[model samples]
Every structure is written in C-alpha cells, then in structure tokens.
Target: MNLDEKMLLLATCFLFLPYQIASVGIACILVQAFCRHKLVDAIKNQTGAIFLYSFIGLEFIVTILHSNWTGLGNTWLFVLVGLYGAYYRKSITKNTFEKMCDLVIILSIFAAIYGLYQFNQISIANGRTFLEFHIFNSPKRRITSTFMNANIYAMVIDFVCVMCMYRFVKNDNILCKIGYVIVALFNFFVLYLTGSRTALLPFVLIFPIFLYCVRWKKLFITSIVLELCVCGLVFLKPSLIPRMSDMSTFASRIKIWKTAFICISMYPLFGWGPQTYKKFYP
Candidate 1:
C-alpha cells in the first residue's frame, strides 16, 4: 500500500481504539503540518488558524481526565503542530487546508449516519461499532450510533452540523441550504436520542449567540422566551421530570475530573510523565 493508504488505515484503526476523535483530528493536523511545512506556515499566518491551534489546549486539558498513551500522543501532536507553525512562516495558499476540512466534514457526516444506524441495530461485523467511534461505552444500551458512546456521537454530529451551516450560509445555492438544514435536523435528532445534558448546553448557548451576532435581536428574544415557556411546561409536567433527570453525567465526571486534578496537582509542572492517569486516577 502507498504511504497515503497506510496513513488512512492507521487513522481508521485509531477510530476503533480507545482514543477520542478530537484527539485523532489533532494528530492528523500534526501529520499534515510536518509533511507540508508550507501549509503549517499558512496556518500560522491566519488569525483563525492560530485560535484553532490554541483551542486544542482545552482538549488536552480535558483529555487528561482519561490520560493514556493515546491521550499523550494527541496532546503532543497538537503541541508540535503549533510550535512548528510558529517557528516557520511563509506565504502559501490555504486551498489544501480547506480541502482537508471539507473532507473531514464529509467523513463526519458519514460517521453521524453510521451512528444513527447503530442506534437502530443495523450494523455488520467488520463494520465499526458506534461505541468505538464515540470514545467511551455507555451503560444500559445507550444507542451510541457510530461512536463508543452516545455523548461523543452527539458532540461530533453537532460540530459537523455547525460546520455545514457555516458553509451553507456562505453560499447562495438553494440545494446546499436545504442539505444543510436536513443534516442539521438529523444531527439534532441523534443528539436527542443520546439524552445527554452536556450535549444540550451547546444548542442553548450557540443558538442565541448566532442570532445575536446576526443582528436578529427580536428573534433572539422571542426564541429565549419560547424556550423559557417550554421549560415551564416541562416543569409543570411531572412525568417529564424523570425523563429530564435521565440526562446527566455530572456526578461521574466530577469524580473523574477530581481524580485527574489531584494527579495534576501532585505532579504540577511535569505531569505524571504521560499515560499515568490510569495508574493514579481513582
């Protein structure tokens, strides 16, 4: 197989491994940066690109809660990419980077569709399980779709939907706009199926941000009021309360985060020397 084919196989394998998709994406960015120095320089020159590279740190921080070899590799990849970009700057076209992003979006859509199929139990062997894509397994048959867990599936689709919406907004094509809406609805439905409280927060936050940024103040206020009314209705319906309570991982995550924080505090400057969270995490 060619080098490109080998890399694709490795990426596919990693998708099934116990690592996060976001981490895998960071790794891909690192590989791209090293192999294409011109692309790295272009990224460094772009303000938004710089922000994206900086944003990877937040992923690293959160992934520390479940630090493993994969987690370390992801973090190091992100760090190396940013450092390399900073050290080298040159004028270069961003067409390749944009093409790569388009490919990622296409793959993410497929992942979302696969996740939906998994929820429906329409999967074959030699095919990836939804749980593997999601990054963690859920208890009581969570319908993870193409992910290891429903939450990851929801998160990934949500981001994909957002990117699609961004692209749609920039184009005047009716078909593209319709496709974006369809994809967005599909992602929203999958997220609802996951019943993840954390997944819901982004919708609550981002919808308003988008409306306000687009200068739709009246519509924004109306949307907020409508949401409040819906919440009130749900609050009044006692049966809905139990369903609402079904969507929290706060306790479990708090426990994990606390353990990880303790490890970080203990090691402070150097951390537990990579892949040590499991050894020390409670």
Candidate 2:
C-alpha cells in the first residue's frame, strides 16, 4: 500500500471515530474506483454486495420521492457497503483480513484504557463513589468511555476480549498466553463498567467455548465451577436473581424493533432510507 492508503488504514485504529474514519477511507476507495476498472469487477464478482446496495439505492430513491428530509443526507452512506467490497479487491492479500482483525484488537485496547480513565475522572460525591457494580439489578449509571453512549461502547468491547481468550487458549508460547490472559481480564472489567445487560452474555458463552475448544474435560469442568462461584456472589443481589421477571429494561429495544418491523411491512422492498426510523418511528 502507498502512504495515502496506509494512512487511511491507520485511521481505523481510532475507536471513538470508527464510522467517520471508515467513511473517509471509503471516499479514497471511490476515488480509486473512478480512476480504474475495479468498480466493474466489484459489481460483477460481488453479487451479495450488489444485492445489498441495490436495496440501499432503492431506499435513497424512495426517500427522495417521499420528501423525507431527516435522513436524506446520510442516505448516501449506504453505498459504502458495496464500495468496501471494491476496496477489498483493490488490495488482495491474505494479510488484509488479519490486519483488519489486529486493528480491532488495538482499537478495543484504547477504548478500555479510556474507560478506566473515565472511571477515575468521576469525583466521589456525598462520600459515595458513582462507580457501583450491580451484577443482577440495573446500574444507576453507565460509563460511556469515548463513545457517544455506553451501549455503543458495549457493542465493540467484546472484540478484544474474544480475541485474547482465543490466543490464551491456543497459543503455545507461555509469554503470549500470560499477556493475553491479562488483556482478557482487563476487557471483562471494562465490559462490567459499561453496564450493558446484554453485553454480559458474550463472556458467559465465550469462557465455556474456549475451554471446550482446548479439548480438556477437566479444565472445562473446573472453569465452570469457578464461574458458578462468581455467579453465586451475583445471585446475592435479589434483583439480579429475578432479572427476567423485570421486563422494564428492555422496553426501548422492544419499541425500536416494533417500529422497524412496521416500517418494513409498509415498504417491503427497501428500508425507511437508512436512519430515517428516528423520524417516523412512534
């Protein structure tokens, strides 16, 4: 890759502005596509991308026809999905995918460190720290880290944790194993502080999967026992024990999904033009 492309790839490491950086890179890819014949190849060879972007293109046209002013500006971004396929073809190499995975890990590490910094930045008030841990009940507040919201932070937090866990379980090198274990623990701590109830499910499933993949029955059973002990501590919180009975927390998600389904039913061929759900959703 040239210096320009290298810089664009480097921009992907910023966890706080992932979408913005990716959009910039997509712009570069589009510039390159105009100068060469690769754009034709992306359409002809990448049928899946073509299908997805065709719908996205339809949505943009529909939004203009409907005069939906809310998400009209952002509607152009849907084309980037297909553009990325073109970008991948521009730099065909096995290491491209591996390097992308590495960037995700690096981005996650930066996010975790920022979260810890945010945790310390909170000043104690009335002799009580704001960073409270409630394993079962909903937390009073959540740490957003560098993201716009804690839930957005939660979505990307698992990337490094799962990566480290796989390395810790499969690596033959003892030093690498130790390093990955430490990173994995730090990821779990950050995941907890995010206070995203749904995000916790990854660790619940990841640990068991890693142990099972290692192919040691005794190790798997021992890990389960240790996890159960941790769960017992959380169970002491009464609300945590009956979280399923408390359905109030999922109200926003249910409403969002219902709105999306209604919109899709109304316009089955295309979505409500990218982020237009915010405008029309009840």
Candidate 3:
C-alpha cells in the first residue's frame, strides 16, 4: 500500500484508542496530505465537496458572530477528517478496504476483552459479583476500555457487532462463521456491561431487519427465543439490564432534546456556534 493508504489504515486502528493516542492518527493524515500536495485535487474530486466546504464556511461565520472560539478547533479537525476520507476513498483499493475492515474487527475484539478485564477488576475491588456490578453500579461503574467514556465504547462495540453479524450471515466457511458469532456475542455482552441505553436502541431496531434480510429461519427463531428470555429476565429484575429500572435517565434525555430543539429554532440557519449548545441550553 502507498503512504496515503497506510495512513488511512493507521487512522482506522487509532479510532478506538484513547483520544490522546488517537490524535496521532489525525496527525498522520495531515502529514500525508501535506506530503502528497494533492489536497486541492482531492477536494475537487470529492462528491458533495461544495456542501461540506460551505458548511465549514458557515460554521466559521457563526463562530465569529457568537465569539465562540472554543469549537473552531473541532470544526477544523472535522474538515480535515472529511478531506482525508475523500482522498482515501479515491485512492483505496477493494482489497485494502477489506483489510481495513478486518483490522477494525480485530481491534474491536481486543477492546472488548480489555473491557471485560476492567469489569472483572472493578467487581473484585468492590466485593461484588458480576451481576451485582452491572445491576447496582452500572452507568457509574461501567467499563470504558481504551476510550474515555463507557458510552463511546458501547457505540464502537455496537458497530463491530453489526459487522460481525453481517459477516456471520455471508461467510461460507463454517469455522469463520462460528468465529464471527463468538466475537459478536463477546462484544455484545461487553456492550451490555457499558450500561448505555442509547447504544442498545440501535441494536433493538436493527436486529429484526437484519434477520429479515438474511432470511435464516433457524437463526430468526433462535433470536426470538433469546429475546423472549431476555424480556422475561428484565421483567423479573429490571435492574438486571442497567438503567432500565431508572426513569430519570429517560426524563433527562427528553429534557435535553427539547431544549436542543428550542436552541436550534432560535438560530434556524446556522447553529449558535459549534459546542455552544451547553452554554445556551438552559
């Protein structure tokens, strides 16, 4: 692979790492872009480049108008990542993309293992059983793996679980299929340990559609049985699924969303400025 391709792979691998470490991936992309001197061509060749550039421009305008410089750095980083994606898309081969996906799956599995280790350590330190750790301490005692937050870790696991499910359905090799299923389940359990209600929402919404698309009768039946069992467990002990017993989280989310909509309505065209939502959210 060329330098750009190598940088793209590096970036993908760094995605699940802690933010401090992940900054290296962003630097790699920027350095590669500068070395290649093809950034202008990359912008020109990318589809919807105009819209992205316009959005960035508008963000800058809004930032200036509101004097909210705190978010401009993030805005610039977002632009850089988008530009790098366009360049990577134009240059990447099918085989390289497949390799990148495999790397992502491998990294995700490692992350899940680490998260499980974190869970075990925390449970031991607190003199609690695994179930107790999740039921009573979760959303507070949740594992973050390499990321800074449990919710972010859960989101990443959610993506990997979907990819593993897809691979399990499509792969012809029985051994490979079994491996995918094992990895998927492993990551999914770790996801549950995260106590992220939002992350679970997508999985609940997607599983039926996925089963329908694959049309595997045995698998579909198995999933339904598993779902019913899980529902029964939750019904008996709502705390078994972390945060499910708590209504306050739902109420807080609704309030936040309502406030966010109100803020957006106040500045319908451009946002009040990136990262300014907290300041104006009340």
Candidate 4:
C-alpha cells in the first residue's frame, strides 16, 4: 500500500482504541497541516461540505464559549477528519476503496476470531454460562472482544457485515467472493456473541437496501426470510432476547431520550456543549 492507503488503514485501526480515535485523528490533522496539504481545498467546491463545516464551526464556537475544552477537542477530531476526507474524497480511487474494503473485512474476521477466544476464556474462568458473565452494565454476558465493550463490538461487526455484503455482491472474483461470505458468516456469530440487539437493525435495514439494489423483488422476499430467521432464532434460543422479559432498560432509555430532548430544548443552538451532558445531566 502507498502512503495514503497506509494512512487510512492506520487511521481505521486506531479508531478502535479507547478514547484514542480523537487523539490519532488530531495527529492526522497535524500531518496534513505540516505537509502543506490543501486541507481547505477538500471542501472548497462542495456546498454540502461547506454547510457541514459551518455547523461544526458553530458547535466549536459554542463549546469554546462554554469553556468545554474536552468537548471542543472531541468535536474537532471528528469534524476535522470529516472535512479532510471531503477534501480528499475524490482522490480515493476505486481500486483503493476495494483494497480498503478487503482490509476491513479481514480485520472483522480476525476481530471475531479473537472475540471467540475472549468468550471462551471468560466462560472457562467463570465456569458459568455466558449469561452470567457480567459485561459492563448489561444484564447479560457480552463478548467485548478487544474493544472492551460488547455494544461497540456488536456495532463494529454489523458495520463490517454491511461492507462485506457489498463487496460480496459486487465482486466477480471467486476467491474474493468466497472470502466475503466467510467473513460475513463469522461476523454474525461474533455479533451474536456480543448479545446486542442493535446488530439486528443494521442487517435488517441494510440487507434489504442491498437487495433492492441487486433485485427489487428479492427485497421483500429476503426481508420476510430474514424476519422468519430471527423468529426462528428467538424460538430456539429464548435467552437471545434477554430484554424481552425486562422492560426496565427500555423504560430508562425512553426516559433518557426525553431528558436529552429537554436538554436540547434548553440549549437550542449549542446543546449543553459537546460531551458535557454526561457530567451535567441530572
């Protein structure tokens, strides 16, 4: 891989680090600045890009006014990298995109394999079922993998599954197609290991869209099949839907969303400064 490819690969990997994605993103920004890269040129001609930066700039100003330094830095990393990507969006060739997708698929497969190891280790150490292996605040055991959180792992696997599905359908190379299938199957297992219902949303939503792209009629049929599969799983493994018996979490989430809306209403323009809600929310 070339320098740009290597940079993207490294950026993707570092993004998994706990509270480190922003720091690495800052380093990326510094590199771009030092290299005299036309960072502004990234979004100069795109109206949507300009609007994006406008919103981000407004948020930055609000954070500064509130003296929310952590929020400012946090927002800076994401917005800066987004704008930078917009600047260089056209530079990423199709070949580069494919290669990056391949790398991502491979990474997900490895992450799933490692998660298997972590899951087994936990089960062995506790001599108990995964249901009893406490993970964070969740009510059940969650395979956190190396991400340190099952929810994050679940979301990552779901995202990877989507990517792999895209390549799986689009690619003609037999070997690559096979690899995508293998990666996708493993992702489902790993996603289940995370015990996250969130994983179901992306697959259920994105798979139909993908099917629509490939064959419109297949979308409906495929969705029905998917729903049946989910029902079948639920029938076979009632434990999979742990939250079905517990509505406390569901209630709390609704309450939290209401509180978030209230907070947003209070700060219509800035919204209590970025990342400050956790500290300030009562």
Candidate 5:
C-alpha cells in the first residue's frame, strides 16, 4: 500500500479512533471489489446483509439528525467488510485467511504480554508509561492490552479469541490447534484484566451460538436455555447483576441517540448528508 494506507493501518491499534483503521480496511475492500466486480453481487445475499445495511443506513440517519457530516470517513468499516467479502474469492488461498487469523492472535498475545509487563513496572522507552494499565489518577494498573484502554483492549482480544478458536476447530493441524490454545489463554487473561462486566457477558452468551455454527445443534439449544437462565438470574440476583444499568455511563449515548433521532426526524429524506453526528451532538 501507499504511505497513507500504511499510516491508516498503524492507526488501527490506537484505540482512541478505530475509524482510521476502518478507513484503510474500506480502501482495501474497495480496491479488491474494483478488481473483482462479482463479489459486490455476492455480498447482497450474505446472512448479515440486513444488519450491515442498517448499520450504514443509521449513520446517514444520525448525520441527518445532527446536521453535520464532518470527519465521516470513519464509517469505512462497512466498505471494508464489503471488500473482505469480495476479496476472499479464491478459496484456494486458505493460508491467507489463516495468516490473517494468526496476525490477530499474535497482536492479542503481544497486548497481553505487554500489559503484564506494564503492570509489573517494566519500563518502556522514552518515559512513555503504559497508560492502559493506569487506574484513575492513582496508577493502580488495569490491563488495557495495546489499545490504550483496558475495556477496548479486552474487546479486541475477545474478538481475536473468537476468530482464532473458530479457525482452530476447523483446521486439522496439531500445531495450529496448539497455537490457538495459547491465543485463548492470552485472550482470557486480557479479558479478565479489563474487569469489564458488560464485555464478559457477551463472551459467555455467544459460546454456544458459536459452537452451534460448527454443527453442535444440541449444544446450541442447551446454550439458548442456559443463556435465558443467565439472563433471568442477572435480573433476579442483585449481587450477581452485571453493570448493564449504569445510567451515567450510558447517558451520553442516550443523548447521542436522541440527537440522531431528532436530526433524522427533521431530515428524514436524503438524511443530513453524512458524518454529521459528532458536529450535531457537540
């Protein structure tokens, strides 16, 4: 890729703004799509098509609601997904996909190891402390992985863990399976370090669904029942409850949604152009 694209890829791990990485991803996808036109048509029939379209559509809605579309380049995530769908046309290059999976695994492992080191007071270069592990103003560290914040770091690791586990289950190699075990342990450590209750819930709930996809129908059904039980218990037991009801934390999100709703109401047709949510929200 060019220098700009390289910068975008580097920016992906920055965490304060993932849209930068998304932009690069979109660019890659678009480049691939142009090279292979058939993939665009194929994308239309995929299972997550509705959700994907809706997600993109909602961004426009938010822009219209807020009457601002500045810095909207970040929404390239959808474009990248589209590109990815098309680019993997040649199934013969299974190694490429495995490599991508491996990259994610490596990144997560690096994050975990770095986090551990940071916690242990292992000095980094040039007076740059690992900010992810810092708790509040006191420096009581929390493992933020490499994303600069523990929760986001954990989420990234969780994502990688899922992908790696899926690949491990499908692949026949013993070494690959062992590598996945390492990835899983590293991911689990990072997840625990974050102490994000909300993030952990989805991980537990999605396990059975993921297994079900791999032909474990009975396990899938059991997971559904177990998920319900988990939810019910969460509602009933005050002490065991997850932090899903923190109004102050989610309040800004509510405002953002409300603002988007009002903007969309005002300009339901054509929407407020694009990337206007931040401008309007502010």
Candidate 6:
C-alpha cells in the first residue's frame, strides 16, 4: 500500500481507540496531505468541494459576527476531515477500498465485543439485571465502547452492520459469509444496547431495502420473522428500548428541534455559529 493508504488504515484503527485518539488519525491525514501537496488538489478536484468551502466560509463569517470564536475550531476540524475524505475517495484504489472495508468490519466486531463487556460491567456495578439497566441513568451508563458517546458508537455499529449484510449477500465464500453473519448479529445486539433510537429506527427501515435490492428471498423471509420476534419482545418489554419507551426524552428532543428551527429562522444564513446551540437552546 502507498503512504496515503497506510495512513488511512492507521486512521481507521485509531477510530476505535479512546480519549479523542481519532484526532491523531486526522492529524496524520492532514500531515500526509501537506507533505504530498494534496491539500489544494483535494479541494479543487472534488465536485462538491466548492459548496463545502462556501458553507465553511459562511460559517466562519457567522462565527466572527457572533464572536463565537470557540465554535470556529470545530468548523475548521470538520472542513479538514471532509477535505481528507474527498481526497481519499478520489485517490483510493479498488484493492485499498476493499481492504479498508474488511478492516472496518473487523474493527467493528472488536468494538462491539468491548461495548458488550462495558455494558455488562455497568449492569453489574449498578446491581441490576442487564435488561433493567437504563442507559440514561448517567452519562457513563451507556455502552460507549471507545467512541465519545453511545450515539456515535451506535452509528458506527449501524454502518458496520450494513456492510456485513452487503458482504454476506455478495461474497461466495461460505466461511466468509458465516463470519459476516456472526459479526452482523453481534453488532446488531450491541447497537440495541446503545439505546440510540435514531440509529436503530433508520437501520430497521433500511435493512429491508438492502435485502430487497440483493434479491435474497429466503434471508428476507427469515429477517421478517426475526423482526417480528423483536417486535414481540419490544411489545412485552418496552424498556428494552429505552428511548422508544421514554416519552420525556423524545419530547426534549422535539423542543430542541423547535428551538433550533427558531434559531435558524432568526439567522436565516450561515448559522448561530456552530457550537452555539446550547446558548440559544433553552
């Protein structure tokens, strides 16, 4: 593999590590881009790059106007990472892309295992049964694994689950298919433990579309039966999915969305300066 590809793999590995180690991975990509003089080309070659930079520029102007300098760092970080993605997408070879996907699935399996362990530990510490443990009991109660939060962890797991499903349908190797199924099931359970209603809801809706697209009749029927069972379980014990059962959390999010809409209307261009949501949310 080339240096860029190797750095990309390194970044993927860093993604599952704790304590904002992913920033180091981002730094690696940025440094490699600088050394290779790929930064400008990365922006210029991509079709959407102009729009991305325009949005960033507008955000910067809004930040200056609002004097929300603290939010500027996040905007810059987002732009840098986005640029790296654009560059990598254009430059990555087919072999490298396949390798990256395989690496992501492998890492996701390990992450899911760690998250399950974290959940078990938390449940034991709380002296509650696994099913009885509420994710929102505290910030630390949810199975974050190596990511910053349960939602992020759930998002990654959701992506990996879809990848696994795709590979399972497409690959001819029996052993590889078995591995994919195992990983998908493991990660799906971990996703459930995450208590990320947003991620779970979308996955539920998208998985059927994937199965339909792949034209897997038997697997699709099996999936339907499994989903029916899951629905039955949820019906019996709504607390299994806390976010669905808890109306208060949903109401809180609704209020936040309403406030965000108001804030957007007030600004109408750019934004309330990145991380200023808390200031205006109330």
The candidate that achieves the highest TM-score relative to the unseen native structure: 6
Candidate 4, which segments miss by more than 4 Å at Cα?
19-22, 33-36, 121-141, 146-148, 216-223, 232-242
Model 1 ranges off by over 4 Å: 1-75, 79-105, 122-140, 145-148, 237-243, 247-251
Kindly list the per-residue Cα lDDT of model 2 for residues 1-282, writing each as its tens digit.
554345335545543565667577676766776567656665667757757877777777878887776556666666665666555565555454445555666667777888876655442422335454432333434567667677678777776777776556556889878877777788778877676767777667777877798787887888789888868877776345324346776887788898888888988876556566777673
What order do candidates take by TM-score, descending? Answer: 6, 3, 4, 2, 1, 5
Clashes of 3: 0
What does the lDDT come to for candidate 5? 0.60
**1 or 2, greater by lDDT:** 2
Ranking by lDDT: 6, 3, 4, 2, 5, 1
Each model's lDDT: 0.59, 0.66, 0.78, 0.70, 0.60, 0.79
Candidate 2 accuracy as TM-score: 0.76
Clashing pairs in 3: none
State the lDDT of candidate 1 residue by residue for 53-81, as single tens digits: 65676557756654555666756766655
**Candidate 6 runs further than 4 Å off:** 129-140, 236-243
RMSD for each model, in Å, please? 8.0, 4.1, 2.8, 3.5, 7.7, 2.6
RMSD in angstroms, candidate 1? 8.0
* Tens digits of lDDT, candidate 5, 117-150: 7554633432445553422212234556446466
- The clash count for each model shown is 8, 1, 0, 1, 10, 0
Native-to-model Cα distance after best TM-score fit, residue 282 in candidate 2, in Å = 7.3
The pairs that clash in candidate 5 are 29-83, 64-272, 65-263, 65-264, 68-276, 69-274, 69-275, 69-276, 133-142, 144-150
Runs of candidate 3 exceeding 4 Å displacement: 121-131, 135-140
Q: What are the clashing pairs of model 1?
A: 115-145, 115-146, 130-146, 130-147, 131-147, 131-148, 134-147, 134-148
What is the per-residue lDDT of model 3 for residues 20-74, given as tens digits with 9 covering 90 to 100? Answer: 5676567667666867786667777889988988888888888888888877766
Candidate 2: global Cα-lDDT? 0.66
